[model samples]
Structures are given as C-alpha cells and as structure tokens.
Target chain A: MSGTVGLVLVSHSPDLAAGLRELLRQVAGDAVAVTVAGGDDDGGLGTSYELIRDAIAEAGSGAGVIVLPDLGSSVLTAKALLEDHPNPQVRLVDAPFVEGAVAAAVIAATGADLDTVADAAEEAWHARKL
Target chain B: MPESSELTVVLPAHLHARPAGQIVVTAARFTSTVEIVYGAKVANARGVLALLALGATAGETVTVRATGDDAPAAAEAVATALRTTS
Candidate 1:
C-alpha cells in the first residue's frame, strides 16, 4: 500500500482555497503531496464534486485526499463524492474550514497518513472551542 | 488624561498572518501599545510570529492591555477587531 496522503481543497470561492494553498506552502515547505481543487465562480451545486473527483483520481491509488471547503456546498459536495467514489480506505475528513485546512496540510506534508492528519484537524477544531 | 482599559478576548482561531495582520493594522491606528498576554509571555501587536507562538485557540481568552493617552479606545478597538473575521 502506498503511504502518501493526497490532499484536495474544495472551497465555495477559489480565493479561500488559494489562500489556504499559499499558507500551506509556507508552512509545509515544497516536499508535500498536496493538491488544490477549488470550485469555479459560476456557483453550481454539483460542480465542485466533479473538480474534487478529478483531483482525487489524479492523485492516484493509495493516496488519501482531504477536502477542505469554505461553506455550504462543500459539505454536500464532499458527501456526494465520497458516496459515489466508495473508497473505504479513502478518508473524507470534515475538517474546520480554515483551521482544519492549515492543520491538515501541515500534518499531511509532514508524512502522516490521511487518518492521522484528519485526527489532528479534529483536535485543532476542538481546541478552537467552537 | 487617558483611562487605561484591559480585557481578555479569546481568539476564535489560531493566530496566523491574516489575523495577526488585522491586529497589527488596528494597533497602528492607535498611539497605545497593545500587548497580548498569554501565560507569562507578552507579545507586541506588530509581531506576527510572536502572536502565532502563543498557539491561542478559540475560547481561550488572552489578556489585552493598553497604556496610553487613548487607552480605553485602544483596548476597545482591539476587542472589536478580534470579533471581526479575517
């Protein structure tokens, strides 16, 4: 089994995803296996899923993709993709939009698995006291 | 001539560049020295890395105190800025 955890960022606006990507790059450095799949500005329900699906597939097998969304559509979009994709090993982490994004990228780039990264993200959320 | 005001405002998220940037910008608007007190450490409003090092998360209030001619307004500005999203 491959040990790389692929990451996908899905946000309502591309700016959020782009901002997250920039932050991740600054924190994670250049050696991480992360990809960004930001939604387009057209604003459609199912559009984001396709981008997410494409990103995951492109990342290849044994690569767990973590999706970070801005709001609203991301929850549904991630759910639909996960249900249709049907990868038991592939984790669909519902991390906090901003905090989780940074945490997930930081964890993933450091060579942790998707599950571990997701756990870290969850821990960060609880720490937020939200 | 100025009244000093100090209060704790829990950061709603981890201290990062965006939030730090907002804080620095707000602090620049005032003449008071804004200090964020976490534990025994105190960080200047202008240092982003220092603020992030606090690792302050939501619900964990950090004490903010200002001493200047406009201390009350300064403290209030900091509080309001923290309430706004970056």
Candidate 2:
C-alpha cells in the first residue's frame, strides 16, 4: 500500500494535542488520520519519543506521519522517533503543535501530498494569522 | 470532514501566549480536529503562533469549531473550557 499521511501530535500537555485535533477537524474533518501521544504529568523527555513512535506504528503502512510538539523535548522526541523508524516517507516536521496539527488535519482531509502537507504546516506556523 | 457543531466564545481575558498554550493543550484532547476563526482569519487550534496571530483579547469573540466522529462532544467540551472565566 502506498504511504498515507498520518498525524502524530506530541505536546507538553496531552490536552494541547487534543485541542489541535479538535481544531483541525473544524476545517479538515475525517479525510485524515491522527494519533496523539503525550501530556504525561511526569514531564519526562524520554517518554515523548515512545509515544510518537507507538502512534506511528499504530497508523501502519501507507500512513506517513507528521508530528506536532508543544515545547521542551517536543522537537527532541520527534527527532528520536524519526531516527528509530527511519521511513523516508514518514516525516517529522518541526511545526508548532497547533500549526502543524491544523495543517496536517487540513492536508490529510484533502488528500494532499506529504510534502505539500508539510509545507502547509510550515505556512500555518509562519502565517501565525490566528 | 465538516463538523456538525460550532460554538463562539468571548474569552474571559486576553488570549495571550500562555493562554494560547492552554488552548493548544485543549485541542490535543480529542480525536477530532479544531480551528480558531476570527473575522476573515483562521488559525490552527493546535498552533500557538496562529492563535496568537488572531490577537484575541479579553471578551473578544472567537469561533472554535470541531468535526469528526466525536465532533459534537468535542465542541461542547472545548466551548466549555474556553468560555470558562479565568
């Protein structure tokens, strides 16, 4: 099966990822798939990677994943997951949790290409247009 | 997927960086997707920068919408959370 776009949202607070998903649904809806991991009270960095990885794995083949992080270990954790999975198609874009979440949601819903989805996320972050 | 429910909230206080962070946290809770829309502008509910860009202030009405299998529940929860007085 060809790789599909998957959303892996990691945030300092699990609520952040949940919120992003809710927001993304507003525009995008069910066209895309999302897996969320994080928001543990412990605030440990190591756990982030595990959660992201697990989410991606659950998404399975044809679901290329994009990660959205809140802050503090978000980027680090995402990088680590990418290293472990090493899927050329699965990308861990450096997008703010909210921006990336929305972008991914929209792209996935519309069936946009992986690169295009990432670009949309980056634009959303930079646009910062509320 | 278009959401079946939508709600408008006038945040109790200015939605600043910290609150934006809170909003992001809220968005992350559900499987559905959410967005923050203002007049002629929209921001990702999960993106802190985008929410801040909206420049929402105390008492500013912002529309938050959600869609998915759990769209209705998610929308109610978000609206309740956002509308709460800080």
- In terms of lDDT, which candidate is strongest? 2
The CA lDDT of each predicted structure is: 0.66, 0.68
What local lDDT does model 1 show for residue A20?
79
* Tens digits of lDDT, candidate 2, B1-86: 54567889888987665456556556666778887888887876666567768887887898888877677877777777677736
Q: Candidate 2: lDDT over CA atoms? A: 0.68
- Chain B TM-scores per candidate, in order, are 0.86, 0.85
Q: What ranges in model 1 sit over 4 Å off? A: A1-3, A41-47, A61-63, B1-86
The number of clashing residue pairs in model 2 is 39
DockQ (CA atoms), all models: 0.03, 0.13
- Tens digit per residue, CA lDDT, model 2, A6-118: 77777766666667767765545555677777655465323455677777776545746666666778777778777866887778777666756665565555455688777
- DockQ score, prediction 1: 0.03
Question: iRMS for model 2?
Answer: 8.4
